[model samples]
Target: MSDDEFTPRLGKSKGEDGKRLVKYGGRVLAAARLAGSKTGVLTRRFDGSRIGRGASIGRLLSSRDRLAGFRARRAIVKTRLVRMAGNGFAAARAHLRYIQRDGVTREGAPGALYGRETDLADGKEFLERCRDDRHQFRFIVSAEDGAEYPDLKPYIRRLMAQAEHDLGTRLDWVAVDHFNTDQPHTHVMLRGVDDRGKNLVIAREYIAHGFRERAAELATLDLGPRTDREIQQRLRRDVEQERLTAIDRRLLRRMDAARITSPAHNDPFQQAVATGRLRKLGAMGLAANLGAGRWRLADGLEDTLRRMGERGDIIRLMQRELTARRLERAPADRVIEGELNAPIIGRVIQRGFSDEHRDRHYLIVDGIDGRVHHLDIGRAAATEPTPEGAIVRIAPRSASARDVDRTIAEIARENGGRYSVALHLRHDPSASQAFAETHVRRLEAMRRAGAVERLSDGGWDIAADHVERAAAFETRQLRDRPVAIEMLSAAPLERLHGADAATWLDHAIASSEPLVLRDAGFGRDLRDALAARRQWLVEQELAEAEGGGVRMKRNAIALLQRRELLRVAGEIGSELGKDYVEAADGARIEGRLTRRLELTSGRHALVERSREFTLVPWRPVMERHVGKPVAGIMRSEGIHWQLGRGRGGPQIS
Candidate 1:
């Protein structure tokens, strides 16, 4: 054929659509071969019958049948995606500090942060790099047999290396190994951005399955594939375990529509394991035998078993703490979980994170009710640092709208949905200026929370559903702070007897409804302390003997508080070589808030002048103004703090 004949050309005749069509002549194959030789093979044909290559294909294959054949090594991976909006970065910083907090090491030192190359990693540097990132990735990876490895860094580095290859991006991450828990684990924090300064979007499928599979692969590599003997041993161990186990999961998956299962697997080993597990579950009331080989699993069996496992862990923790303290309490007296009828007045026995990965904290309190109770106090940052041996009052946080919210709503309703301190006072003429200012503070808090709007005219724009918004705001707050914790006394019960401070024991003695004490544990100890304190009060002429009980003189608590304040002030004055001045009620005080003093009376702020200093009652508002100038008036109720643009500025009651 000639070259002209081999060339492609449009047909002379048009199609029915009036568009010319290209007709490939028989010599077109020769032209294509000539073009292919010039351009090199444009594309190669892939085998449609075989599985494709790449990480995604491997992930799909693994996710579908990952646990088949030999028992795969178990690794628990918990993940959280935190958006770094508003104060989220601040919370992330706090989480880093918490993970590196003291007593997390094998020798009870702080946890050490490390990266791929170094044994010591700077958490601040990592956070600084992530400061502008849109979000962050947090993960807790725990291998079931992690303790078998001496250090987790090697395994974690390998896992992350595999992840980087799988995700096709370089991950900026830092991790801290925690030996504090029963199972050694690593907390890995990956920045949201990739190497090219772009937001790293990980596939949800990869996060859900691929990452865990990678961890299992690494673990299995290090520990070798599970032997038949090892697999049988683990299965045997799971038969009587209270927690949800693999056997239980298998049985659950195999159950018929009637929720009936039978130990009749083709594999004799699995059948025996299932039968043994069912009998154990039957004893635990989680399963019922239907005679023969059939068994009926209970409704909510998974939840019941999970809860049982948690309760068992809690009891073990409680017993461990109590034994460490050398304190003896009957198991019957131990209260792990319950609703508090009244506030729990107790000396803190121990306080630590319950779920370290989530930063959830717990407290073991020795209550005056004669019971040792364990309380889950939610997030660590939500509550103040409660030192061990401090006396505290824990009450359930109310989610309903406060009376202040109702008052603000009522006032705003009459004033065209606008509320101000002036409007609050005008609405309720009988309300004190200080009381009305309290409502303004409440409004300021709500405004900061975006539940209400603050206008330029020093007023709040309240919506019609203001009360509901306030309730919802409080409900959101409950996620972080589940309960209200008040530090009644910073001192322990043993130190309160002879001390000059006005302790909780003194208040308990003066109250009409005294705490009912049992003759056991902290109750008996508190009773003795109260007796010694009463004797000390008599010596100080603050109380007198009266019919088997001492009668407290007028203002005994105030007197004791004043005594301690004077003593502490004198010491502070001597240290600074400055005179100590006491501020009188209605006196206008102006100076710098130097530091805070936690007196037995209450928390007081030390206001320092050029020549003299005075200890004034501290308000929560003053915390942000520490080391800054403050001007306020000492009132009968409390200090009336004046903050910001003169009188028009914010006034905290």
Candidate 2:
């Protein structure tokens, strides 16, 4: 039979129709078998069957024993998954450096990095390996009894080995054990890639529960199971503690509809502990005795307690820092929480991480307001490092819409809810291109935050409520960076009085408004320093006494700034054997940024060429580019820095 003759058609004979039905049934059966195999594979993968039996077993045991009466050894594990894109690599490098910073060791030396086999691991080599990684995993593991172990290295190694076995893959990781805090802990940085160079995908349950359980298991084995006496002692301590404790968590869990009944316990110690904790809670106004052995939990009890705990920590930190510096202030003079109605001019007493794992930083400031203030300045990278004793101004970051946002909204409204540099310029012909570009940058930031939309044509699809959206975006940013810190002087007040440069005191003198200073702490010192600075300026003929006040010359600030710059430039020129040239406005500056010099005027960068060098205003963005070739135009507001080579380089204003 011919092929065409055998082909099935609508009017085909019964034999052809049977053949077609049989062929179609076979295809359908094959498809069904394939689908069944895929479903089976997915089921095995997700049903805790293929993800290693050890991890599954560990998770089961952890959940089972969580509510058991006996207290096991505890471990706190904080994990963060960081995506390595854009500036992520730089941030990762910074984090590595931060974790291995000095004074983290038991002997007050720098923290030493280690790997699975070696006691000393090269952090740079590890970073090089992680350069091309898609993401990274950072973990901070702290055993409650970590100090019991003579050394934490072995424990950390064993814990990591357990994790590797549970995950069924070799992990590329390094760790550093820090003994600086009361609770000794280890910081582990794991590469995102597995042994076979594949992206490591850990289950959420594993990261959240399995890993901590594994650590706790290792700790329990090393320290032995917590004895009844140890458990009771810890529980008793928690009962009277100001912080959130295990007993509070138990009470919260036992509550029915925000009311908990104090039931008789089989263990008298536990009953006493529970009763004591409830009474403590009542004293703190977190629980109300509803009578009949019942207590009503207050709304926001957890939040209030957490805040109280944080305040207590802040107070302790302030006390420790002040005592170390030999500075004394009354407990009532310490400000833990308050609204900063005005910018605080102060000396930074101490700078440290409030939450080290999250890189949240805080500052203890001896303010000119005559109070010691603890300010949560947010992210570590949000502000430039203001060293201890440096004078700074701390101001609340405004969440309201700025003038740039209003300008963008107005221009977008005029152009049918579309914004671009071209539209901005067209809307206001008098505005400079640089000014218009600022609006585009604002829109770009909002677009990245997902608060606004960007068109394919490189324009923003501005909404009618764009201003409100801008405000909302800033409000979200405030959670990460709540305050703006400006370094007024790198030198202390005592040193700035005799300095030749135009200092913060000079700026204060030039201002029309008078500074309000109290006669205590930093405030008293600042008043004396200002008096000395005014006397020095008068000695230099830059100021004159008039009407019981020191009056600065018409161009006193300019003259002082120029004098200091000249003196510094002369010194730098002598060292490099190169002539010093002053960069004028609109001057094309091309040279390598050699170093940074912090003067009373401001931070300045020394850019050196073959024959000559110039000092330009320094920017934080230039920090990473130090020793690299830099080109910029000195502008009236600031230098427009062209970072990197080629036409597509980033520009910073």
Residue 345 Cα positional deviation in candidate 2, in Å, after optimal superposition: 1.8
RMSD of 1: 7.8
Candidate 2 accuracy as lDDT = 0.85
For model 2, the superposed segments whose C-alpha errors exceed 4 Å read 1-55, 67-71, 338-341, 412-469, 635-637, 640-653
lDDT of 1 at 596: 85
For candidate 2, the TM-score is 0.86
TM-score against native, each model: 0.89, 0.86
Candidate 1: regions farther than 4 A off: 1-66, 644-649
Error of 2 at 598 (Å): 1.7
- What is candidate 2's lDDT per residue for 316-376, written digit by digit as tens? 8899989999887999899974456568889999999999888899889999989999888
- lDDT for every model? 0.85, 0.85
Backbone collisions counted per model: 0, 0
